[model samples]
Target: MASLLSDIRTKYNLLSKTQKTIADYILDNPDATILLSITELANYCSTSETTVMRFLKKLDYDSYQIFRVNLAKELIDSPSETINEEIAEGDSTSDIKRKVIKHTNTAVSDLEYSINQKDIDQCAEMILNARRVTFFGIGASSAVAIDALHKFGKIGLNVNGFQDSHLMNIHCSHMTSEDVLFVVSHTGESVEVLNAASLAKENGAKIISLTSFSNSSLAKKSDVFLSSSTNDKKYHSEAMASRIVQLVIVDILYLSVFMQNEAKFYKALNQSRIAVSLNKT
Candidate 1:
């Protein structure tokens, strides 16, 4: 039995029209269902009280009150509970500072606990030996991909980062057995990114996946998987910590490549400097 209202929606087509109306209302106003009585819900959904009762029965609940109670309990235990309902007015500066510090510290600690040296080493080895490297990410992660390109280029490696889905597919189509494709996804479920990784795999390119979820689609498809901690406060803040972790991984690879081929790294650095000097007034 699915307890989530989302799951209930999946089975909604099986319900009667009146029951479906109540289900839609409950889904849209989950908090209201917990706080409002059956009469109130019936009036709000423009349905009769009997229709609400039948809706609960279809969901396998014995009564409307029981359904509301369970829904309230679920809401209380949900991840959104950690999110503030509204910003408090006239908040002290110190109070705001403390809350920020606490969440940041938690994010750092989570990242520390999640790191694995063995995985880092393996990722480094694959990257060092690959004939070509391609990076795929979207949104904020696209920024991370750009940073990776800069770092890898500095160390005398051929790296490309793509944000556009169509261009990414085009790049993946050119991948061969000697190429390595690194995919960065915080949620691990970005459809376009996963599809690119799939295409890269089909082309025989080695895949390295960086994501927060160990069981994510990209992770499941990769030849090597690296996970960063994003289990902090449940919002974009969690992704901030994830980017920090991804940057750390990029730095590790940069250092490892430099150490392995110091002369080549120095040559690349000098060439970059001279190129900049040529453009100077």
Candidate 2:
């Protein structure tokens, strides 16, 4: 929803001259463009409606109305955040800070566009109804797996996390149809994670994956997959950036499950807070 401007910028260099003019018009006048009808926008761009429609088609927008709706939300959410992830060697700490914030904001906005809310809701339903939940990940993704374990366990969901591939394989072999195996992988093609996911599926567990690539094997293997916007090749920053997306998705699913059963979850959550507080003082 909020990825319109980002998509425009990404495809800017590839656009035809006329399309580039349309791109410039939208990029420069997002607010005004949202208010203008398609013909009016075409008029403002000094282009025909066919050219405008063709431009939206390049962006994968099926209808002008939906394009405007998403574009309006994009403008409201992040009107001026230009996504620049490439950090040069001589960049200042301040520059790094700004770049990181901008990248994260843009990544999240891209996620808002790419991710499916229905899939999220379905995942929430699957998780909340599952007899037990298991999380699996490797390397950097292991941290997110453990975080999910901690968050869901605190709220009284039967949850565990396995970072060791061998352990994941062994544990997954025992999963039943009532089980939900939540896998975390940045690439979604991690060999170990996929092997374990396959094992879990063979044993009749519902698999849900959080990954950047929707077409990845892990995503294809799962009952539901949540897409993260860490699709860049910035080796130094990709892992770190994916972590931000991972944490946001985890929090969203966590909140979804909690809100669905607020009274019961609030009681469990309150008990957890009380128990943790006892050791603090």
Candidate 3:
């Protein structure tokens, strides 16, 4: 059930020039490529069969047929889902608004399809039982971690979000088997996040990762992994859609925990609401 398309997209930049050319063609016309033989695909890409075979090897496929089989399966699994959303030049405000809404809706829909209930249950249980929970992210991801801290902390959980690498490392150093670390990284390759996760794991804390890409370093290190949709559109490329999807997952986690033990957390939730409402003019 490994998705060849996801693998290709996740590692596209790491491929060689010839391999990228083949990858581009395949991504553009995956349905067509699935029906084509290796020679046909090579000719279509204006590359030789040897080059195509090399590209397959780069993808870690033993044979082109297996690669094609997985590609076909990916197409079947995803159907018409596309991460690339188009915003045309000289479009009106309404046009941009509609496109943005559609893209965000698609991302949320994909999350509903991508997340597994078992993973959610396990993560919720970990959060419920952990002595302390730590959230770690950097840059834009730091905002996400901070938001998670607010949500989880409001539930009476001993939670903290660390933005500084040194602070996160220090926190991890004091962590024990009763702690849980939740990491948010779109690429799962952030040096600071990885360092914190490694140190936390060494200190016997459970790690939960929320990432867009599967088979990433953070994903491999996590006790629980949750995937989100990619926001790779050319026009809005600052991970806008990806961040929304991640926040939604955080909301889901928060709700799951609250629903499981509403009586225990209800007072804290109402207090948070009352505290925020006090600021109203």
Candidate 4:
């Protein structure tokens, strides 16, 4: 079953003004409003009871009561129950350090709640069976793609990460069902990444998307949608937190792939180490 939170995010763009306000409140305080009455929710959202009903209908819920039940269920099932707060302006160095570390750890811990083990195992199987794996990302995600390329290559996987827009298109254009395309984007709305993903899908390549939201375009197009937690303060992009989660996901995928063919992977790992060690001396 699709979680109400994910469904809300997917349909957020189509909501009315009053509906958006209610959505914003629910998203910000999911754990709190799960038990609120329709009257209370409407008052809290600064809208009428009718608006609440309309909003529920918009999301395809049978009734407001059903919506509340689903929302509560989603909150309970969510990966991380960590309540996010904005970083204060005045803080000691130690305070800042503690805050950043805690937030990063929360992001990683939340991944356990968001991703299913079966999905991870399935994706790993796809990677092992794929003739080639091509990674495509734009902006900060490009760095993640490159990192994944390096990690997987050490395990002797046929992989490459593409940063250049034209090159990404060119490479994806030639891919077929035998290939796997990994697209990484925090917002999942990168135009270049979407274009390449579309071309790859058209050419019959399976897409594995790593993003922060499951309702994003990239997620919609993916054969497997992987999401990470994202909570950034005002004026601060999710560049750091989201990137950390992306890297962790990459590491998990790499490890899963490594475990699948342990003997062969051990040989490849040793050979790569020797090749690099020779350069150091």
Candidate 5:
């Protein structure tokens, strides 16, 4: 079913001042609106109950109860209205393109605002100067860790990422003060990753956490914390946007490290090229 209050807002100019007030209240607090009786809604919006009844009828509902039931259904079915709201079908290609651009732009802007420059610099410096860098992640985050290892390794840094929990624990146990441990988790509360970070800490390794939330357990345990932001949808399906933010942070770290030690970075680059050329022959 269509959103009743959105319809009212779209036609707001046509609504009476009393109807408008009720409409605004319903839009702002949809869940609470569903729970209120017609009399309660009238009192809450400072209008007569007759106005509330008229408002529901104007929206094509047979009664206020039906209107509220439909609204509650909408809320229950879509917990995050920002992401779950349906887009109207477009009749032209340009209309579709415009919608796509708007969505992408919002995601990009969200990521940009969520990042902190100082955190990025600190993480890069720690990794660059460390004698060894141990990357830890599990499941989806493990893929990120492996990707980070590939980039950091190219810049002449010793880096390793482990997916297996047992292997991760074994590696963390060997980390020392001269080493750095980078933990990646979207939730920042993954049990295996947190345990690994704690073990690395016990061994005196400086820990850096890359997570979506700064207040997560992994972040609290780390020596430095870097976070990426994504607009969470109803199903928490912000993975695509979140991954983009994470990769951006990773790129920043990689470049910072490269710039901090330009000579070593370029030397490693040349060596990698030579090795690839030799293998191709």
Candidate 6:
């Protein structure tokens, strides 16, 4: 039922002994296997990164991130998938702790490879120059948009986040050449997001997107696209892993933008903290 394993089953005959060993661990203990880093996996298989890379090359996987993401999706999709996999319920608190860190670190590591420095430079510059900024997303992605709205608003950017699709579509009418619209979508193919983005473009707003794929429609619509990668599809909360990665991107952009006008942002940040402090007590 694991789609990735099924694909590998056909290629089983073609793999060398070392590749077969890696495949065996994946096919036999998929739940445990998915959590391992390339180094950890190699340790489990008694092999080296070279052999792991060669094995992945045989399977046609593009990168370790994509392979792990695809594997996670396939495991979740399997009707027979169990909560107690080979990783074991008996794993000590420390074992679980190490895994939690490694899993998160792996995702962040992928960001370095997927992110484009040039795109960030352009987007940060555009956001700084913009008269107004708006962010839009639906479902889990909406959380990302709202978070961006909060971060930027604190630095004195006139920012808005619309959680409702209808309101976002309606807001497109207000967009202008001097404004920047930041659309956050994990899959980058959401119809509601596309509708809003298209209408905003029609009104002459510059579109900036944070999405998982560079080739996605939202990317095509944007004047600049900032990418994050994930294939995590659990509960149809499609953006779960990508959401964390996107937040990192948001933080990077926030600092980059803030750095461009440090003195102005310093004053705005000070003012925001003071205004919000009134509610704290």
Question: CA RMSD for every model?
Answer: 10.4, 6.6, 4.3, 4.4, 12.6, 10.5
Candidate 3's TM-score reads 0.75
Model 6 Cα lDDT, one tens digit per residue, 1-281 = 22565455434435777887787678667888778999999999999988998888877876887899888987787634222122346878787666545444545555665667898999998888888999998888888899999999998888887888888888898788998899999878999999999999999999999987667899899999887764332232455557788999999889988998899999999999999999997
Winner of 1 and 3 under lDDT: 3
Error of 5 at 165 (Å): 1.1
lDDT winner, 1 or 4: 4
Higher-ranked by lDDT: 2 or 6:
2
As for candidate 5, its clashing pairs are none
Give me the overall lDDT of model 6: 0.79
- For model 2, residues 45-110, the per-residue Cα lDDT tens digits are 899999999999988998999999988887678757533556668889998787777766766666
| Residue-wise C-alpha lDDT for candidate 1, range 71-157, written one tens digit per residue | 888788763422222114575777666555554444444444455678778888888899989888888888878888887876668
Per-residue lDDT of 176-214 in model 3, one digit per residue for the tens?
A: 999999999988989999999999999899999998767
Per-residue lDDT over 155-273 for candidate 5, one digit per residue giving the tens place of the 0 to 100 score: 67888888899999999998899999988898788899988998899999999888876667888998887766443332234465566667777887888888887987999988877
My TM-score estimates for the predictions, one after another, are 0.64, 0.75, 0.75, 0.76, 0.64, 0.68
lDDT at 106 for candidate 1? 43
Q: Candidate 2 — which pairs collide?
A: 1-113
Tell me the deviation in Å of residue 210 in model 3: 1.0
Q: Which stretches of candidate 1 lie over 4 Å from their true place?
A: 1-98, 234-238, 277-281
TM-score of 1: 0.64
Top TM-score prediction, candidate number? 4
Cα lDDT, model 6, residue 71: 84
Model 6 ranges with Cα > 4 A deviation: 1-96, 231-237
What TM-score does prediction 2 earn? 0.75
Residue 209 in candidate 6, Cα distance off native in Å: 0.8
Off by over 4 Å in 5: 1-105, 235-238, 277-281
Worst lDDT window (10 residues) for model 6?
Answer: 79-88
